[model samples]
Target: MESIARQSVKMCPFMQRAGSVQGLQVLHNANLPAVARKCPVVGHAMSRAYATASGTGARRATAPEPKAGSANEMVANHATQESLFDYDGLFETEIEKKRLDKSYRFFNNINRLAKEFPKAHRDLEDDKVTVWCSNDYLALSKNQQVIDVMKKTLDKYGAGAGGTRNIAGHNRHALKLEAEVAALHKKEGALVFSSCYVANDAVLSLLGQKIKDLVIFSDELNHASMIVGIKHANTTKHIFRHNDYDQLEEMLQMYPRSTPKLIAFESVYSMSGSVADIDRICTLAEKYGALTFLDEVHAVGLYGPHGAGVAEHCDFEAHRLAGIKSLPDKSVMDRVDMITGTLGKSFGTVGGYVAASQRLIDWFRSYAPGFIFTTSLPPSVMAGAAEAIRYQRSHLELRQLQQLHTGYVKQGMKELGIPVIPNPSHIVPVLVGNPDLTKQASDLLMKNHKIYVQAINFPTVARGTERLRITPTPDHTDDLSDILLDAVDDVFNELQLPRVRDWESQGGILGVGESDFVEQSNLWTEEQLSLSNNQLNPNVSDPVLGNLEVSSGIKV
Candidate 1:
């Protein structure tokens, strides 16, 4: 009896839109037999009877189906409603905003070079354009050694790691690469992630969430990844002024010494090319019982004697030059509790890592979902990264040549009266100050001059700080440099942009002595001028000196 009733229920069909309306009316109107209306199953049959009588069958046969422009359009229209939420309207508004502001990003599809690197040209509308905004600083992405290792590993292991690290994905290549990175930074252990951004986010989030009464002191200019991690952790955080050690110290003093604190910052700021005072930051961290989390993503595989990072270089340089080890308890690299770096930028591969004590690494490995849940990096990537790191370790000449190129471009820009952000680091930013102008200069450089330098604008840097960030590598030749400068000069003239400081009257040299030059450099705001003046060492000839003199018409 139960089986027969269930079968009857299964045999009943659901009514269409019009049938549903008529079926509801039949329930209100006493038009059915008492037995048919009283029994719930029979009542349902009566409703169906009323639906059929209401011309539902005729409506189904006579009404034509709605025609759709496309399958995607049909689905989109059905899924979205303007009354609830207008995703298309929101997108259109954002597009219009970007268009009006002239800050829309253009993705130029570039073909990989077989031989030439940093010096290689990109394919854009049937023209070969030189790229000046590549993050592959050392041009190791196209290195034959790195490529050969990756190819061999790919052939041996096949593509894709079959599972997460805890499963079948655990491989010798990843283990070896982790070990190599650990040794590079002189750490007890290291864990690899999909990217440096992920490493930073995972490690920071875990640390902030786990630590008791945790307080994160972050630089105001710290990257988006670090900010996201700290924000998600829901911990107390203090944002210090960019590169301002005094402000950082002041903030640290407010926090109790017993509280677990983390000083999170980057070694090299990408946009401005400003180097952080890592030594001083470490000192303050020790004074206030704070662990230093340094992101050396921009500095690793570029700076330092062994291409470890800036912290390593600073320590090595200090010991070699002054024979004065300022910190008695910890070496420079040791001062940093967590060091996050990437294989993508200078190393010229993909992925990121965090190097620290074995216990810290183990904690991350056990607790971090980003690491535990995601598929392990393929054997080829690990092999390639390991090879790249190994090769970079001994290649000091690449570093030197890169510095030379940076110095050449900077000095040339200064002589040409172009407003270049003065920094000791290997980045050169030509200030445009306006978004429209920045985009215009970049477009002119690409279309007319065949040179590509991306315009860095709002959210990347402040809105008024829009500029073209040019990165010169070891492979960017003297001829190429000349062409780039000339093209930039032409654009500046055409756009009627502001020129650099009038230092020609002061013997055509930019130094601390020239107050007008210092004021006009536009490297720092009024608040930063005093700090810059104090740090400017006029006698120093080293290109990496925080405040070094720029001689007129200087060339490499």
Candidate 2:
């Protein structure tokens, strides 16, 4: 009898739950005769009388053949308001708001020529412009060796990464890339993702979702990726003001030392160029029994002895003396629980990664959907990324020259009374204080000077704090710097934009034009900057496997 009852239920084709299952309803609705609706079973199915687990009769406005239409049908009938919701109108209204606020993002058609480094063409091949705002910190994007490896890998493996890492996508390139990343940060293991944004989102969200009562302390200035991860984490979160260790400690004090907590911050806040006190933050994390999740996206491949970023840069001398291994106990890099970075920037490739202890990385690899389900980066990209990292590891001159170039631009800006928001790092953010003018300055530079520096505006930064963000590549010589400086000065004068003294008179905003704006010493000190690539530890050139093979599930 029980077996018969089970079979009856399986065979019965009544409305399963609600109208949202439109395909099922459509299947039966098309087959059932009108008289079939008179039958009790058919009637119930047509009316969707079956109870849903949620005990709600409400259905999606986009589903069902009865009244609610299917997603495709609604989109097809979007010109009419027959559907319950005006889906198209909602999207249009949101976009219109962006346009009104002067925040509508316009995608410029700038094609960067790899061989020419910062030189790129606008629209036409002949319309050339110097890209002054690229995040390619080390200019490794144009490195011949990196390109050669990528081209070779493309020839051998073809384009796509077959599939996700667990599938055919897993290959030697993935292995070597992860290995290089792990070694770069002196971590035991690493996991590559589609992008660092995905990496940060996956790691933080997975941590919060998995750990019960997990609390995340995030810096206000942390990237949107981290912010999204924390939001999806769906747990308690305390947002500390940017780099406010004291506030972070106070928040941590609320939770017991044994409570699971994660502090997410960046080594260098990209917009402001502010440097974090990694050692101090590490100390606080230890005292509070919290794990540190440092986003080194902007810092990696531009800092430290071997391009490991600010955390490694924190213990610069120590990392420089020995290879990744043999660091002093709990060195800054060692102290960070997880270090998430991008290969797209200084590594000159298109992928992101997180490096950490073997166990933590394994857990992230096994659980984080971003890594587990997302398609692996292409073999050529992985190969190019690995080679970029490896090449940069032994070459300290790139980072040194990058810093030197940044200093040159900053000095020239100062001499011209340009309002450069000062920082210790290589980024040069010139405050325009108005979004309209910031855009104007960017357009003018590209039009008149053939310099492509993108304007930074809200919601990237707060309103009234718009600026022109410039990044100086190692190859942007003093001659180019002078041209850029001259053009910027001329633009500000033409537009009547506020100069440093202008803002100083108006009472300084965000360190600009402030009488007390403290000048920060560059991240690389004069003594450190004086040293050449020859001084970098020889072991950096040696492939220190660390935990790459032991922990990698890819099984290369």
Candidate 3:
């Protein structure tokens, strides 16, 4: 509570001997610095900084703090007190909003029976349903050999990987599995992670963080994992329209060629069955001096001569003709700097990987906390996944059959006046524009028809684009197709869902029932489909495919 006047009066030794007015006049007459005049101890030179009369740049030395628990301190403590925020209530309100909007998800207990292939039991062992929305595109999960390999390795290596790779988890199985993944994408090296979700998140994050001023150009409709990784990277980002290369090019042009950039996209967009032009995107990346990050999670075991993915499939004939050499010429897959894929989907195991140049792979292996801190996949899974990749690579028949099944479902849906958002890949997306109806339709399919097709709602796909994303494997045969088609027809009729005609009448959306919608030819051409496994090149080696004895003999 000491004033400047009182401080000066108290500070001056002369003021103690002389009267207050006479002592003040003596100090003023001495012409000391304002700070010195205020207190003899402070020797601040700038009068403006030490000025007692306040104006701009006028500052006062801080007063000493009161002792703890002093009566004067009570007021200061009261000023800092703040009420607690209702954090749990905030979560409750957000969840309630999702519930009210019908975007809330309710999971079904559908346990897929390995023996049954495509048909799964729900809750009870006997309570079965036809699975229409699983991502096991080639049905390799049902292969007895793959299962046997997993079982044998499981018996040998135990249930879990001991720890992360840097600890006890690094072993021959991990190396072999990584080799298979690298060979699948024809990359110099590959690094495995707990899941592809983690792989995308880690790789994209590392690129943006390590490379200074790295700008990421992501597809607007990219998977949530990529988007999350981009956000975590905390760098400049431009989201181009989904599959709109022109907008992407324009944005790329705005940046100098020397500027570090990355174009992150997916090979096959899971929601709409849409396929990206991998070659074209690669070309743009090359032109703009941008690194390409392709997520082939959905397309890996469903495309290319060796089931490498859409990038490899872009030059199918060249790869297929390469035979023993693997790479006769540079390919779109080769040009792509990084490719991420899952062992869980087509490979029928559970993990993810990034196949890239040796330096990049090594960099991630050393730096990515997502990979470093997490437990490694069990040996059985690694073995099984490697087997699946080798199995699919040798069997071109599986991809063909999957394409055939997808075609059948799409054809049936079109013929039945069902609103199918068309694309060239092996996905059958039956668009239901309303969230409530999408949920209702998904529930009804499982309840009445015993068909399980999970509803796609907002956040996964955009609003008003809710759909039932159907995935057809090689095992979904003509008989099963007939059943699925008939059940779907009945469900549509009962639900009174909009048909193709209805969508067209409403001016169409997402390529569904649009009057000017261009019909996309299937990714697999007629000639390609006609050629079978018997026509495959004889010189190709199958290093990763073997029984237990040959486990360590993998050459890939």
Candidate 4:
């Protein structure tokens, strides 16, 4: 009787769309196959690779179908007249005027690094630290070529756009950039947002609203903006554990396969510097009849073959910019969907973009509050980004040199007994173990040796996994490396901690425990504490006092 009732519930269209299982709604909407073979064309490469590595390729893959009810019909039946204005029954506490401890939050660690390494500054470190904390990978922020381009654009277009893209902001240069970006990704069309954050937020929210009964399956460790956008969608969402493909597959299998599904993720996670397996994800999405939205902010200038990102990068150079300098020559207008990126990090400017279809761009320009309500980026800024992008491609040697420096530092840290996470990426982090101790170590390095490293703590990282995020750029020379090593050695020794070498020799994982990593970095020692206490107490330490001569005529 109960089994029959469950089957009846599953047959209902509204129940399937709502993801109702066992009389309760679940997050995900689609069930995908265990193996990637369901999508033949895309998964062929993976299948072959897996087959060669393993003994057989006869593994069965299964995906559940939707019940009698359709997700589209369920969504259409539930549309509300005041849906846009409806704030009730939503997760109000998460969004509505929440308070946070702003005082202790790490808004910008780069600024802190500047204060610590004052002598390294080219200018006023108090005002501006000359240190290498900025991920301005292309040096576009200060590059003369970028400056020149900005000046030229400003001269031509004058300052601000004065209106949204739909208004007067949609200039020839903007269109050209969008086309160039779409070509870079080899997509049908691309849309540009003001910032990468804005792009993620707007894209997720807009897509969720546009698609009638959408279910989003997002990476657990996705950036905050993506999380915010997903929350705003107010529909069912599933969070798969960080990089756990099996777990993701399991979640997909349990979801009702009626509603449209979307997978949102990033290529390179900024904090951890972990790269995503995009091809696998895309394959899974396709198998489940889902679309993919990738944030290539970190990977845009560095990852792919032509820097298009993981998938395109693995394949081949999608688009090669010809000797043409200016936007377009009234030809080659149509392009693919948008790829979003920021000008700040790699491009060395301040703006963001989305490269998508003209229709999508037109729609976003009309609606998306972030794009519509906000002031557009200055023409000079866009010009600078354009120049930066071009400069990066032309000057491959310089970029290689920077990467080499990063490699040298990573190697140095490993040799010196620091437990750095293993990844080929440039950003290297030294596991410091605890939040308080990590902060103390950073302070000591700054005060004594003027070596600055930003201390990353929760909720940036999980609790008990705090670390010192050390970024080594090209400007950080070999001499600096020696100084840094020596300083770290001195500090570690002074703290009365066991040497990193001795621990490594014993095959012990350094910084894996509180005693190993946290307690070792504390600047204060038991002996030092005892001496301080003795001095503070007058009668307790008579020996040193008696040895000292009286200054006045009346001596004891």
Q: Which stretches of candidate 3 lie over 4 Å from their true place?
A: 1-83, 539-541, 544-556
Maximum-lDDT candidate: 2
lDDT of 2 by residue, 128-177 (tens): 99989999888888999999999999999999988886786477788888
Q: By TM-score, is 1 or 3 better?
A: 3
TM-score ranking of the models: 2, 3, 1, 4
Kindly provide the TM-score of model 3 when superposed on the true structure, using C-alpha atoms.
Answer: 0.84
Q: Score every model by TM-score.
A: 0.75, 0.85, 0.84, 0.64
Each candidate's lDDT (Cα)? 0.75, 0.84, 0.84, 0.57
Off by over 4 Å in 2: 1-84, 542-547, 554-556
Candidate 1's TM-score reads 0.75
Model 2, residue 259: C-alpha shift (Å): 1.6
Residue 177 Cα positional deviation in candidate 2, in Å, after optimal superposition = 1.0
Prediction 4 TM-score vs. true: 0.64
Which portions of model 1 miss their true places by more than 4 Å? 1-82, 119-126, 317-329, 502-556
Q: What is the alpha-carbon lDDT for the whole of candidate 3?
A: 0.84
